[model samples]
Target: MCTYATVQTTLEGSAKGPEGSWFAVTDATVYFDHPVHALAEHTLNIDFADPAKGPGARVAVELTAAAARDLLSAIQEALDSAPAELTA
Candidate 1:
């Protein structure tokens, strides 16, 4: 089993394709802002389809430039509030 530590956050949105409406708890998504700024933007986009093996996995990350930064920053709040344990 993969350690939960790898996942810095969990996105509770809709994930389309393959898995259909399933929860997707993924690892951290690290990236920079721009070529000029380069490493100036260090953010991670963590998310999950659902709390369990249910529906709601039908989402995608569609952003542009600075918008990406905003979306990532916004997800930070969810990360800070996610639990480190599996729920029953």
Candidate 2:
């Protein structure tokens, strides 16, 4: 079953896309749905994009549920271990 829930937010960052090129990412779109390329039936999908640049200026990732949870944990750990001043 698809949750059909999506979360989008504005972000200021850079993401490497095709051809080993980097682009400024101004938005993030996260959703859980059927994978476009992954073999899994359903996966967590994240898209970092710069809408002003066009649809091609984007980096996408699709991860299995387990992997997504692991990534979440790793992100939290990395943030937790960082210096408060740097993170703040």
Candidate 3:
């Protein structure tokens, strides 16, 4: 079953895309849905994109549920270990 629930937000960052090119990313869309390339039936999908640059300017990731949770924990741990000034 697909949740069809997507959380979209604006972000400021850079992502390296195809052709070994880098682009500025201004949008982030995250959702749990069917995977496009992953072997799993369903996965957590994230797309970092720059809408102004068209569809090709994007970076995507799809992770299994377990992997997603582990990634989340790792991110939190890294943030926790970093200095407050640097994270801020």
With a 3 Å backbone cut-off (N, CA, C), the pairs that clash in candidate 2 are none
- Candidate-wise lDDT, in order: 0.42, 0.94, 0.93
User: How many clashes in each structure?
Assistant: 12, 0, 0
TM-score of every candidate relative to the true structure: 0.30, 0.93, 0.93
Error of 2 at 8 (Å): 0.4
Which of the numbered candidates is closest to the native, going by highest lDDT?
2
TM-score (C-alpha, index-matched) for candidate 3 = 0.93
- Tens digits of per-residue lDDT for model 3, 14-34: 989979899999999999999
Task: State the weakest 10-residue window (summed lDDT) of model 1.
Answer: 28-37
RMSD to true structure for each model, in Å: 10.4, 1.1, 1.0
**Is candidate 1 or 2 superior in TM-score?**
2
Clashes, model 3 = 0
